[model samples]
Target: MPLVRVDAVAADPQQLDAIGDAVHAALVDGFGIPADDRFQVLRGAAGDRVVYDPGFRGVDRDDGAVFVQVFLRRGRTDEQKRAFYRALAKHAGLAGIEPRNLVVALTENGLADWSFGNGEAQYLDDPPS
Candidate 1:
C-alpha cells in the first residue's frame, strides 16, 4: 500500500479529490498497486504557507504549486519508477495541476515498515499476494 500526501495552495474540495483520484490511478496503472488500496492525506494550505522556488531546477513554478509525496514498499524496477513518474505527472496535469508546479517525491521502505492498524506491522505478519 502507498500512503500519499498532497499539499496544495488554496485548492478546493473538488480539486483535492481530483488530484487524489489521479494519484491513485497512477499508482494502480504504473506501480501495479491494487485499485482499492487507497490511503491519502490531502491538505490545502494558505498561499503564504505554501512556498516554492519559482525557478527551481529551471522549472517555473507559481503560487499554485502542489507537492505530492508517496511512501511505499521498495521493490519496483528503475523502469517502473520512471513510468510511474510520467504517469503521475500526466494524471495530475489532467486534474488541472500544472506540470511545472507539480512536485512529486517517493519514499520506499520494506515490509517491516508498515502498520495498518492494531499497532502491528500487517505487511510483515501477513504479506499480500
Candidate 2:
C-alpha cells in the first residue's frame, strides 16, 4: 500500500483529481500495487506558494510544476523504481501536466511503521510477500 500526496502549482480542482487518478494508475501498473488500494491527498498550491528552480537538474520547469511524494513499504528493486517514474510521467502527462514539470519522491518504510486504524500494525500480522 502506498500513500500518495500530490501538490500542483496553479492547478484547478479538476486537474487535481485527474492528477490523483494518474498517480494511482501509475502505482498499479508500474509497481504492481492493487488497483483498489489507493490513498491520496491532492492539493493545489498557488504559484507564489511553490518554489522551484526552473532549470534544476537540466529540466525546464514552470509555474505548472507538480510535486508528488509517496510513502510505502520498502522492497521494490531499483528497476521497479525507474519504471514507476516513467509510468508516472506518462500518466500525469495524459492528465495535461507536462512531463518536465513532474517531480516525484518516494519514501520507503517497514511494515511495522504502519497503523491502519484501531492502533494496530495490521500488516505485521500477515506480511506481504
Candidate 3:
C-alpha cells in the first residue's frame, strides 16, 4: 500500500476531497493496487508552503497548484509511473484544477521499512497480503 500525501493551497474542503479521490483513482488504475489499499493525507496550506516555477518544465502553474507525493515499495517500472501521472492529470483536470498546476513526486522504499501494526515489519519476509 502506498502512503499518499496531497498538499495544496487553502481551498474549500469539497475541492480538496475531489483532488484526493482523483489521485487515489490514478494510483489504483496505474499501479494495479487493491481498491481498499488507500492511505492519504490532504493538507491545505495557508501561506506559501508550496513554491514552483510558473514556467518550469515548460509548464505554467498558479497558486492553486496541487502537490502529490507517493511513498511505496520500489518495484514499479518507468512506464507505470508515467501512466500514473497522466491518469492523475486527467482526473484532476476534470475537477476544474488545471493540469499544469499538478506536480507528482514518487518515492520508494524497501518492504522492510513498513510496519502495518503491532510493531511488526509484516511484509519483510513474505508477499504483502
Candidate 4:
C-alpha cells in the first residue's frame, strides 16, 4: 500500500481530486495493486508549501497544473519508480511536458505493522494481500 501526498500550486479542488484518482488508477489498475489495500492521497496547495528552487522563477503559469510527489515504503526499484513517474505524467496530462518539469519525490520507510479490519478480527500486514 502506498500513501500518496500530492503537493501543487494554484490547483483547484476538482483538479486535486482528479490527480488523486489518477494516482490511484496508476497504482491499482496499472500496477496490479489490490483495490482493498490502503492508499491515502493528500493534496496541498503550492502557496502552503514551496515548490521551487531558490533562484528559479515559476515555470507553471500561476502553477495551473498540479505537481505531485509520492512517498512509499522502500522496496520499489529504480525502474519501478521511473515507470510510475511516467505513468503519473501521462495520467496527470503531462505527456508532452518535460520530465524535469514534473517533480516527483519518493520516500522510503521500513515496513511496520498495520491492519484494516473490525475490532473482532485481525489480519496479516501484507501489502496488496
Candidate 5:
C-alpha cells in the first residue's frame, strides 16, 4: 500500500484532483504498482500547519508548492526514490520551482498484520522469508 499526502495553500479542487490523478498514474504506470494495491491520497491547505523559512519567499503569495509524502509497506532504494520524486514532481506541476523548493519524503515499514479479502488473507511478515 502507498499513501500520498499533499500540503499546500488553499488549493483549487481541480488542481487537487489533478494532482491525485497524476500521482496515481505515476505510481501505477511509471512505478509499475499493481492496480489492485491500495493507494490513498490526502490534500489539505497550509493554514497553521506549515512554516516557511525566513530567508526564502515566493513572488506570488498564493504560489505555494505541494509537499508529498509517501508511506509504504516496504522501503525503496535511493534510486527508486529519486525516480519517484521526479515522476511526482512532473505530475504535481512543480517543474518551474527550484529543486530546493520542492519537498518529498518517504517512510516504509514491514506490515505485521494487514487484512484483505474480508479478512481471509493477512500479511504478517517481511520479504524473502
Candidate 6:
C-alpha cells in the first residue's frame, strides 16, 4: 500500500478527491500497484502555511501550488518513476492545476516497515503477488 499526503491551499473536497484518484491511477499504472490498494491524507492549509518556490527549477508556478507525497515500498526503476510523474501531472492538469504548480514526491521504505493492523506485518507475511 502507498500512503499519499496532499498539501494545498484551501482545496475543495471534490477536487482533492479527483486529484487523489489521478494520483492513484498513476501509481497503479506506473508502479504496478494494485488498484484496490489506496490510502491518502489531504490537507488544505490555512493562510500562508503552504510555502513553495514559485519559480524554482525554472517552473513558473503561483500561490495555488500543490504538493503531493507518496510513501511506499522501494523498488521501482527510474523509468517507472518518470512515468508516474508524467501521469500525475496529466491528472492534476485536468483539475485546472498547472503542471508547474504541482510537486510530486515519492518516499520508499522496506517491506518490514509496514504494519497493516492486528499487530501483524501482513506485507512481510505475504508479499505482493
Q: Pick by lDDT: which candidate is best?
A: 2
Model 6 spans with C-alpha error above 4 angstroms: none
What C-alpha lDDT do the candidate models reach, one value each? 0.87, 0.92, 0.87, 0.59, 0.60, 0.84
lDDT of 3 by residue, 1-129 (tens): 899998887546788899988888899889989989989998887754766787888887888888899999999999999999999988888887888889889999988989889888889867675
Q: Per-residue alpha-carbon lDDT of model 1 for 73-127, expressed as tens digits?
A: 8888989988888888899889998767888899999999999888999888889
**lDDT per residue (tens digit) for residues 20-125 in model 4:** 7767766664455677654666565755865565224544433444456555556777777777767776766632333334566677764553344454213234
Q: Rank the candidates by TM-score, best first.
A: 2, 1, 3, 6, 5, 4
Runs off by more than 4 Å, candidate 1: none
> For candidate 5, lDDT tens digit of each residue in 1-129?
677776654456676676666667657754567776646665657454666552355423334555667676675677777777677767556433333445567778666534445653356533332
Q: Which candidate order results from sorting by lDDT in descending order? A: 2, 1, 3, 6, 5, 4
Error of 2 at 39 (Å): 0.4
lDDT of 2 by residue, 1-129 (tens): 899999999889999999999999999988999989999999999644788899999999998999999999998899999999999999988999999999899999999999889989999997877
Candidate 1 vs candidate 2, lDDT winner? 2
Candidate 2 residue runs with Cα over 4 Å from true position: none
lDDT of 1: 0.87
Q: Ten-residue segment with the worst summed lDDT in candidate 1? A: 43-52
Residue 116 lDDT, candidate 3, scale 0-100: 88
Say which prediction, candidate 3 or candidate 5, comes out ahead on TM-score.
3
Query: Against the true structure, candidate 6 has what lDDT?
Result: 0.84
The model with the greater TM-score, 2 or 5, is 2
The superposed Cα distance between candidate 4 and the true structure at residue 28, in angstroms, equals 2.8
TM-score of 3: 0.92
Candidate 4 residue spans exceeding 4 A from truth: 44-49, 54-62, 94-101, 113-129
Tell me how far the alpha carbon of residue 37 in candidate 5 is from the true structure, in angstroms, after superposition: 3.2
Model with the higher lDDT, candidate 2 or 6? 2
